[model samples]
Target: MPLSEHEQRMLDQIEQALYAEDPKFANTVRQTNPAVHYKRSIVQASVGFVVGISLLMGGMILQQVIVGVIGFIVMLACLLWGLNAWRRVAVGGEAAAQSQTKGAEPKQRRRQQRPGMMNRFEERWRRRQEGDDR
Candidate 1:
């Protein structure tokens, strides 16, 4: 449901107050993007993976079992980390695309566009708010 006029006004007032109290913090929060963070993580993980490869090779050449084991562990960890970040980016990109497409639809159509689980949860919430126990 859309916010009531009073609620909207109050929210606007709160936002203005926050900006006035600390414009720098507010700006930083507003400009921060999760995708950028994910991309950076991916780059870091890739570099770590390369380092692991070198360590593994060096350990092999030096005839050190411990170093080779440690390098293998590092490579495995970095591979998992990079894969996780990539997965998050893909999921987030899908959500962003869905939201953008949703904005183009009519309001009535938008209401019908909610996923089944979300619709059920909203319905239950509405029932509880209206004093219906079942």
Candidate 2:
């Protein structure tokens, strides 16, 4: 179902947050047009399997049952190729999860040291050293 406008805005916000969080993963997801990818894989696989069946039937008409059987096995294997193709392109969905990972983000600049406890400790130590110097 299509999302309502409100839901769509919400989704957009979430997507922006994700992109902000992890541009690399967002790029990966954008690389795949899933519908086109899946359909091409399925169609190619189906055509291969179908051609294999046609060859099998032609062999049977030639009274070459052994050849026909071999062709049929090949057709089965080609049909399985469809599933394999789908698997190969199926990782696009994981981009959402990747967006949650801080480390997955592409590098910009290195992070500046924050004014956390470590900074505070360093500041205190520096003050003591300066006092000793004086």
Candidate 3:
């Protein structure tokens, strides 16, 4: 729902107060975006993968099995992290695109197709509450 004019004014006042008290924080918060976080995560994971490769190579040269194992673990972790970040970015963009498209599916159907963890929990909680009410 759209905010009322009074609510908008109140929100504006709150925003102004925040900016005046800590402009740096307000600016940072405003600039921070989900896409930015995902991009950073993917970049960091790629860097970590390179470091893992170096570690593995160094371990092999030094004949240290432990270091090699550690490097392998690090590489696996980075690969998973990068893939997860990519998935999040893709899903978020896809959802927005889907929402904007003409002849979009009903919200109920779309939601049922992909019930997230929180959604499942909420459903369970609602059922329990209804049971208690009876």
What is the alpha-carbon lDDT for the whole of candidate 1?
0.89
lDDT (C-alpha) at residue 116 in model 1 = 74
The collision pairs in model 1 are: none
Model 3: lDDT equals 0.89
Greater lDDT among 1 and 2 belongs to: 1
Question: How many clashing residue pairs appear in each of the predictions shown?
Answer: 0, 0, 0
Residue 83 local lDDT, model 3: 97
In candidate 2, stretches whose alpha carbon ends up further than 4 angstroms from where it belongs are 1-35, 86-92, 95-134
Ranking by lDDT: 1, 3, 2
Per the 3 Å backbone cut-off, how many clashing residue pairs does candidate 2 have?
Answer: 0
Evaluate all candidate structures by whole-model CA lDDT and list the values in order.
Answer: 0.89, 0.78, 0.89
Worst 10 residues of 1 by lDDT: 107-116
Instruction: Write the residue-wise lDDT of candidate 1 on 1-134 in tens digits.
Output: 57999999999999899999999998998899898999999999999999999889989999999999899989999999999999878768667777867876786676787657778999999999999978
Q: Rank the candidates by TM-score, best first.
A: 1, 3, 2
